[model samples]
Target: MDKKDRSILALLQTDAKLSISDIAERVNLSTTACWKRIQCLNEGGYLRQQVWLLNSKMLGLGVTVFMSIKTSHHDLQWLRKFALGVRDLPEVLEFYRMSGDTDYLLKIVAPDIAGFDRVYKKLIQIAELFDVSSSFAMEEIKYTTALPLDYTHTA
Candidate 1:
């Protein structure tokens, strides 16, 4: 990753919809060169899948909740069942196996308190949890998908 490659990545991270010509101009590279570089970045797995971040309020999902789960079962089978149960739920936007007292954490989006309760009930029916706690966000102060590129190095 040279300076030109870094520049291209910075631009693309800001907006994946940018055209190859626009990226080329911003990075000061020829169109062909920029295209090939992007291809290399994709092949090398440095560039992952691009995604659009949606506005929660606009989509009728105004409530954001973080759920902390603690499970008594630590066996592989139990963990697999829990993972599958949560994975099938569309409301679960993010899931992580935590390292602290909580066994897992999930970020859920819903329309309101009733909607969140429905999701919670469905989740508990799938797998028995020792403890489940939810924290609702009053507002989304900041959010972003862009990754800092300063740590990347030219190979």
Candidate 2:
């Protein structure tokens, strides 16, 4: 992507509510050009779906646990079953594949200890996973949706 595209992305990253005209004016481009650029970005898969970030505490999901999981197998058959099981669990806010001793890392938000217990029991039934390391989020110091703009690449 070019600098102009990056600029547009940067603006949208901060506040997606900006109108096409507003964006065009700021970037010194015509409205049609700005709209076309946005459309191209969407078509090219640079623009993902927008989200409304919610407060877990206000939603009565005050407990946040980061669970590190180590699976017995990463084979396609076992992975498929694990994927399906996680989809049914409402408490799993985020699931990620990482590089470490853990195969999967989950960011789970539950209402209480009882909620966590129920989810944990269900996880065991779904896969042959034996290792789990869970940590609680005591306080959030830095949380951001914006990516850093300072990556210098050599091509």
Q: Candidate 2 clashing pairs?
A: none
lDDT of 2: 0.84
Off by over 4 Å in 2: 150-155
Best by TM-score: 1
lDDT of 2 at 9: 78
lDDT by residue (tens digit), candidate 2, 1-155: 66667777788877878999999888888999989988897899877877767787898998889999997797999988998999899899789888977889998888988888888888889889969888888887787788765562312
- How well does candidate 1 score on lDDT at residue 9? 86
Task: Please give the lDDT score at residue 52 for candidate 2.
Answer: 66
Candidate 2 lDDT at 14 equals 79
- Give all TM-scores, in the order shown: 0.95, 0.87
TM-score of 1: 0.95
lDDT of each: 0.92, 0.84
lDDT leader: 1
